[model samples]
Target: MPRYLFLKHYRTGQTPHPNAADRWTPQEISDHMAFMDAMIEDLKANGQFVGAEALSPRGTFVRYGGEGKPPVTDGPFAETKDLIAGWMAVDVESEEEAYAKAAYLSSAPGYGGRPLYEWIEVRPFLSEADTPDLG
Candidate 1:
């Protein structure tokens, strides 16, 4: 099976609803957890689920030009224009299957009575065939 990445992208500074920030009470968190539990069960039943996780927003990116060239960068790169919020990797039989899974995931619930303006980007992972089978 081929591995595909389902990446979630969203705008960083937009509130979904006027009172969205205020809606993050304990009840809202519980409801979100329940929804996630159901989604996990659904994914497992379909046999398309490999693994998933949530990531912290904080990150450090390093960029290097050449050997001993001294990498330059700092925490929290200010380039959120094309930043990826989070992602999930799933193993599927084909591109069609990958797309189907991504579509299903995008339909999952989110805060503010709808998804967080997020979009899923499905990309196939590079395989050994892409290069030479080192074996």
Candidate 2:
């Protein structure tokens, strides 16, 4: 099974619901958690679930370009438009399988009704055989 990463991308300041700015009530969070639980169960039953996680908005980004170049740049960059919301990694048999998984994930219920502003980017993982291992 090949491993693939499902990345969630969204613009900053996009709320899940019109009233989301008010903060999640306990019931709202509970409902979302229940939906996630169901989704996880379905994934496990299908053997398509490897692992998943949500990431924080803050990140440290480093860029390198130059002779004898030391890495430059630091966290808290000004660009919020291109920030990643989160990611999930899964192992599947083929590209078709990967696509199906991503489609299912995108349809999963979230904060409010649905996350219209969110998008999923599926990418296959690189295997050790595909590159020379330094270690």
Q: Model 1, residue 55: what's the lDDT?
A: 55
lDDT of 1 by residue, 25-98 (tens): 66655665576567667767877677777655455578885887877666556354345656778777889988
Model 1 earns a TM-score of 0.68
Best by TM-score: 1
> Lowest summed-lDDT stretch of 10 residues in model 1?
12-21
Q: C-alpha displacement of 132 in model 1, angstroms?
A: 5.1
RMSD of each: 4.1, 4.9
What is the Cα-based lDDT of residue 97 in candidate 2? 89
TM-score of candidate 2 relative to the true fold:
0.66
Instruction: Show pairs that collide, candidate 1.
Output: none
Please give the lDDT score for candidate 2.
0.68
